[model samples]
Target chain A: MFSSMTISQLRTLLRAREVSAEEVVISVFDQIDKVEGDIEAYVTLCRSEALVQAKRADALLKEGNAPDLCGIPIAIKDNISTAGLKTTCASRILDDYVPPFDATVVTKLKEAGVVIVGKTNLDEFALGSSTENSQFHVTRNPWDRSRVPGGSSGGSAAAVAAGEAIAALGSDTGGSIRQPAAFCGIVGLKPTYGLVSRYGLIPAAPSLDHVGPLTRDVRDAALVLQAIAGWDGKDPTSVQKELPNYEAVLSEDITGLVVGLPKELLDNELDPEAKEAIFGVANVLESLGARVEAISLPHAEYAMASFYLIASAEISSSLACFDGVRLGKRYGEAKDTTSMFMKTRGQLGIEAKRRILVGTAILQEDNYTTYFVKAQKVRTKIREDFQQAFGRCDVILSPTTPTPAFTLGHKLDRPVIMYKSDVYTSLANLAGIPALSVPCGYTEGGLPLGMQIMGKPFDEATVLKVGHLYEQQTASERRLPQKEVKANG
Target chain B: MELSLKEMEELALIARLYLTEEEKKILPQQISSILDMVHSLETVDTEDVEPTIYPITGSGVLREDEILPSLAVKDALANGPDIVDGYFRVPRIIEEEYES
Candidate 1:
């Protein structure tokens, strides 16, 4: 039960001395022992290290006046570096590569006194939509083991949903965080680009990458965001802006708030169940005194294509450092530098290689203007679309994903189908706005459906507030996937 | 646009990935389809629009010239596959020419 508690709930008990940090950690680890074999959410578990941190947190609690997250156990996606821990990014190339220093967010989390449980699995270099692309193993949907937990942050979302961790950090590049969080039936927030420092996140796409929180509820997301959202000199792209207190906005009313439902997103090939769930959210918002209206993002249809081109182009350049020279595993023997480069780079997984190859071709002089530059121009249009829509409404609402979690390996062979899963979610990344996925309802099959609330740049306060309001109204829909997991097992 | 096997091989070479025979057989079709998907970007009229390389609006940050303690050589070389004198060891870059 302690493992299943939210951060706010655990904080009360921890501050009151009713439950020690060590007890919470042990309970979480116990749950891990119960279902990790079937769920496969984590790539690495630091039980001894977590226990050590928990014991430290208990000591701090004895001193009184500790941080809100003090003693909370949280998971970090494998792509984010943790000092003295292996940060594999779920790729074999970096299996034994332990970081000598922590990522900027990891450093911030440590300062807040949260015990890091472990590194969760992800797609190789965070390249794919499903954890099946993970070099380690597939992370199954806790709601249905036969399905994926959505990725490349699948493990983080799954861990939080199944009570393996109270909350977790996941990086979003083209819905890596939101999609998985939606699939796993939890709240996931992708902060405005440059809001969180990306100094240590293994980059999938630098321009599009954002590090954010995936938690059991919207309040927990705000708490984690409070700890990690800031600028760092190490990350030049990080914006120097004063962050609003995200937790303060949670109780605010949405009486006159205008929520926009993009006509373009709804007109796409959406599942009937997902469409129904999206409309159901509109009704709920309207009942809360918020006005919902249909808005158009004319260039929205081109987001997916532009995102893939931009992301792949950036990924090709970003991953060039793994040439087996400075770090990471090098492949077979070679006589010369060219052959060595080729052999060492051959360690990339199929999807990674595919993206890199496509990226390479896109960046070629002949195709540069046709693909890469065109995608960037289209990206400008996408951002303009969001800007125009936001002028008419405070926030936009849409399905976090087109549908709930699909069966594993269903779209594995079809790259385009897998890419299509990100269509609705990637628009936020392309526009560099904040988007949060809160569980709105569930399908008849019992899988969760998520509705995304997107806000203007650096307006995370409004986004979190909207999500928190919806979450409070729909509290009954919040259920752990444990029973479903156990039944499937 | 469909790519030929030769084109796929060229891309693999540029990416520095060594594709196997089977990958060579399947990748061309896969890459071509992905290309076809992305080609939709061309349909949008972007004649005069400026490209967005970075999403944020501000100019790049420039720090003052200052000496800062950085990663230790031992720590930097800790994860290297092969190291010599605290430097990464790699295959020979310059090839030796021989008289025929």
Candidate 2:
């Protein structure tokens, strides 16, 4: 089906005039209409807007004045701003707040002539691992109707997996992209922090925030990354280095590449199936002439705690702007300034409130040195651990998440349990290294299993190379989850 | 150490959040447990360790001060709940603040 074709395939078809840009876009919207009731992937869909953009893209494609992603329909996580689109971040506070400017990545995507389908749902402010925290609605895993498509990028991942969009963009602070990509059985890359401009991405935790692509395959991820990764003067933290041609790296051989298996990540704590899947990928790499070895990263045990404390502290600082002042839905009668501000912020979701409160507590006068400073110091140790490990291996391999998608609402009440979902994935964010989750296989329950590959800073080429190689070598084709809902006649 | 209700309330105030009575009742335990989960970080010896703030090694750049067009007043006021005279109008702290 046109909807199931990868960006590269669709690009070839469009360039060859076998399928028009409008046809692909229309198929995508039709697919979205057929499946959206079952999987609530998007919060705001730009139907008419996308049709207009598709017409423009068709013109560009016909003129041969377009890039590889020209005429492709892609979804943006709600947190990424598109000018005049309501970028809610899946929170009520910004429900009606349309952005005046497109994010740097959005601008780049438009320049490439890609059609944006709409804003996908996310954990409110991209705070949770599950879209259950989204104020609008919960996005379900296409693999299992009752299960969560791992989040805070669950909507983006779900949309791509369900053929709602050919590919989508999601921002990862702590496994927001990778984990959901795993859950949805697709390719998700978290580029090295600062590789992508964060100018218009609503910040969850700036220090850890990264915007990357979620695609059905590794090559498509590379295509999207090529378009989006670059420095922007608007984002001072953006890397000033020259962009790598990710597409070129995909064709490179993996012979003699040393893949590291962190001993800590493979310990008895992992799900048996996930552990086997990682080892299975190792075997595939081994057959491909790549060597896999066990490596130690001792400080990784402290990653989850360090990430939460550090991320929460940064989130507290970044979210300080949404006090019904600059742009957000205001609540209650205007009493006094303090009360109005308090009531306005009272509209924040429970998860947002939890982070804000804990984050505020950590930054308090008495706790700053104890919690915030200590976490920052641990962060240095975590980065050092990766530095030392990468000294011996080209890339590290592990299960992207500890387990496949957990049943919906399983860990909702237990904040600690929910936080554990990102334990294996957050280490990359801590070290500011690049990581990608590629579908390894599936568990017995038919849910997706993900294999994670980590590379040294600015070495996304190697990471994508390894993932692309594995994706190419694996003989198994992805088994799409059986659809549970059918369109009414 | 688990936080008491008073401590949680203090945090809520610091966070500028207004919690419901049920939230006030449940949040202390929740926040206390999360704090407890992070308490394990103290076991790590971080003495004399320099904190890493920005992970990238490069120093911040100083851009040349150049004049650029700013956001249009209409776009700026587009999402505002209340606007007056091309500015976001908030509850008056002092009448002279918005007197134009």
Whole-model Cα lDDT of every candidate shown, in order: 0.92, 0.91
lDDT at B29, model 2 = 91
Q: Candidate 1 regions off by >4 Å? A: B97-100
Q: How many backbone clashes does candidate 1 have?
A: 0
Specify the highest-DockQ model's number: 1
lDDT by residue (A1-489, candidate 1, tens digit) is: 898889999999999999999999999999999889889999999999999999999999999978779999999999999989999999989999899999999999999999999999999999999989999899999998899999999999999988899999999999999999999999999999888999999888999999999999999999999999887889988888888888988999999999999998886599889999999999988999999999999999999999999999999999999998888998889888778888888878889999999889989999999999999999999999998999999999999999899999999989999999999899999999999999988899999998899999999999999899888887776677665666227
List the DockQ of the predictions in order: 0.76, 0.68
- Report the C-alpha lDDT of model 2 over A120-234, residue by residue, as the tens digit: 9999999999999999899988878889999999999999998999999999999999999999998999998788999999999998999999998999999999999987888
Q: Global lDDT for candidate 2?
A: 0.91
lDDT of 2 at A305: 92
Docking class of 1: medium
